[model samples]
Target: MTFEWGDLFAGRISGMAASEIRELLKLIDRPEIISFAGGIPDPDLFPSAAMARAYEKIFQSNAGAGGALQYTISEGYTPLREWILGYMEGKGVRLGLDEVLVTSGSQQALDFIGKLLIGPGDLVAVTKPTYLGALQAFSPYEPRYVSIAMDDEGPVLADLEAALAARPKFLYLVPDFQNPNGVTVSADRREAIVALCAAAGVAIVEDAAYAELRYDGEALPSLAAIDAARNGGRPATVIHCGSFSKTVVPALRVGWVSAPRDVVNRLVLMKQAADLHTSTINQMVLHDVVSQIFEPHVKRLRVAYKERRDAMLAALDAHMPKGVTWTRPQGGMFVWIELAPGRCGVALLERAIKEANVAFVPGAAFFADRSGANTLRLSFSATKPDRIREGVRRIAGLLETVEA
Candidate 1:
């Protein structure tokens, strides 16, 4: 007498889709494979030693001072929230501590936003090739995704307005060094999108995970900042998510949401239910570390990653086959590429693995309709410069064979 597993599930589970990027990662573990697939930051850049020292400091003096191991407010550690508020102000984003809610990672903010706003069949506006993780995050709620046109500068405002006209529940944007594409929204475009969304009564989920890593050119203002400025004296219609994962350390899982005070209160309530708040012990350690030592760590990352980004760009220019075009990202980890029409990035992966011995994320996974068959994403953050050059050369060789 066997019990059926299908009988125990909700109908929503049937439509739930798996993340292709996560699936692709299974093949990326081999040392022989030069993978440009993951959005992972450099492991070497993590300040493990600094973190250790900070943890010691927290325990020696402050562990029982606030019961670091004991559960605290679901709103997260106040000192950390205060630090983030101060930091945002330093970056020109005006916000109060009450408007920020500490999340487990920026990714969890995505999950929470989806949890709060998305309902069945709701419209969600996204770039044609947006972040796959967002799609995975929101899939369970079963929103109908609408893709807006994107260019080198960012999402086209006309297309975005058209998408908004459909009355989307919200628009999710990576805006700063967008995942997979590695494009940042220009100041003008950012203003246009913000104004359009605000007027149309559409919410904007600004995922600025890679905001701090700009390699060249002036830093662009955050959508949250622009939204705050536009919405009278308070932030409105913008739910901003940021993380230390890309900027500092991923393992510690420190991320945050900055939204209107009321919205943040709701998120905090939801957070209390989710995990009873992100680890307080880790939060205390981070408060100490970021305040005392994070700047130098970020500086080292900038120097090392800039060289790797440049190496990938140089290699692509020298090695990629004709008709294969790629974005030269100013900062952040990825570069988006497009093969000549009629080519399939996933189909080419078999050859890439057996012949070139390199791996890349097929761009189709980044699209809702899975139509960018000719596209691919390369990550320069984790790989060293020499390996980047070698990987690009091998990928080019594979492309030549496929094109031939």
Candidate 2:
């Protein structure tokens, strides 16, 4: 009569690991803690009023209410897909309406891309300290990872060429203001990567979630754009994933993939089996809100996040002891910090919560190889400037203690 649930679980379940940031979020709920662990957008910038108006407008008429509330095509709402096409084209990555497949969020697109491309023991090329969520998304598929080294501009071309020799299932890149690291691939490097990958018959999964969140420096051409240019405006070699969560509203859960027609079709099949489709009402409302106020809203976010980033950078400079270095991100929510040699970020995190009352994600979680024990990622998006200053100061104090 006893139930043994663990014995009945699938083999893939064993490969899954909890996200460290998600776990840390549960323990840092105390109002007194100055948490820098989550890459969350500031709630103050959400377009609540505009979203409300869009929702009200959608329900104002019978035709509007019926269409929005009803289940739609698995490919996604047509108008939204068309709008995204125009948006991508404007950014230099030309996409037809058929090339776009809307998903619950770009997170879902990651999962679908993994499902489409990765198989057990297949190799995937990734940046050394890439996005943590990508590693988590691909882990259940049981793929091996080849981490290419990165420099200030982006992945080292020589290292990338060596990795490409393995003929990975695909190369995953977070091109603009990459998560955790906040480094953007330069335009020249983007072209080189595209040419090399295309020549080698490899595909690229371009996660552009934070591409639109730049705070400084001139914008670089996206890998998708360069790929399109190389392929004569057809994105045959790239599966570009983008999300509205960072630039628009996170709660809306709207994101999309722009790829070749065949890839789009395959992803649609996977998407249909996964969730039928993204929420009908949410998609409609997102399309409405974006049509009316996207530019102004994103501009507001850029200004706000830029200020927070500046504050964090200044605080780090003023407080951090010698040998503690960090990246000066051009834009994006995170700043990657490296502690002095022999320092452990995981150990520092434990003491940070208990003694310093500040929290951050250890860098090990972001590395597919589980290296970078002396590094950490600090997110400056959700906290106020004053809290950012205090948090960095507290962290700097902890580092000094470690040095002593």
Which prediction has the highest TM-score against the true structure?
2
Residue-level error in angstroms, candidate 2, position 81 = 0.6
> What residue runs in model 1 are displaced by over 4 Å at the alpha carbon?
61-66
Check candidate 2 and list the clashing pairs.
none
Candidate 1, residues 284-344, lDDT tens digits: the string is 8888889887778787888999999999999999998899999988888899999999998
Worst-scoring 10-residue span by lDDT in model 1: 57-66
Residues 1-404, candidate 2: write the lDDT tens digits: 99999999878777689999998777557888999998988888999998899999998999999999999999899989989999999888877788999999999999999988898999999998999989988988989999998888899999999999999989999988888888889888898998999999999999999988988888788888888887778798999999999888788899999999999999999999999999999998899889999999998999999999999999999999999999999998999998888889999999999998999999999999999999999999999999999999999999889888
TM-score for each candidate, following the candidate numbering: 0.97, 0.98
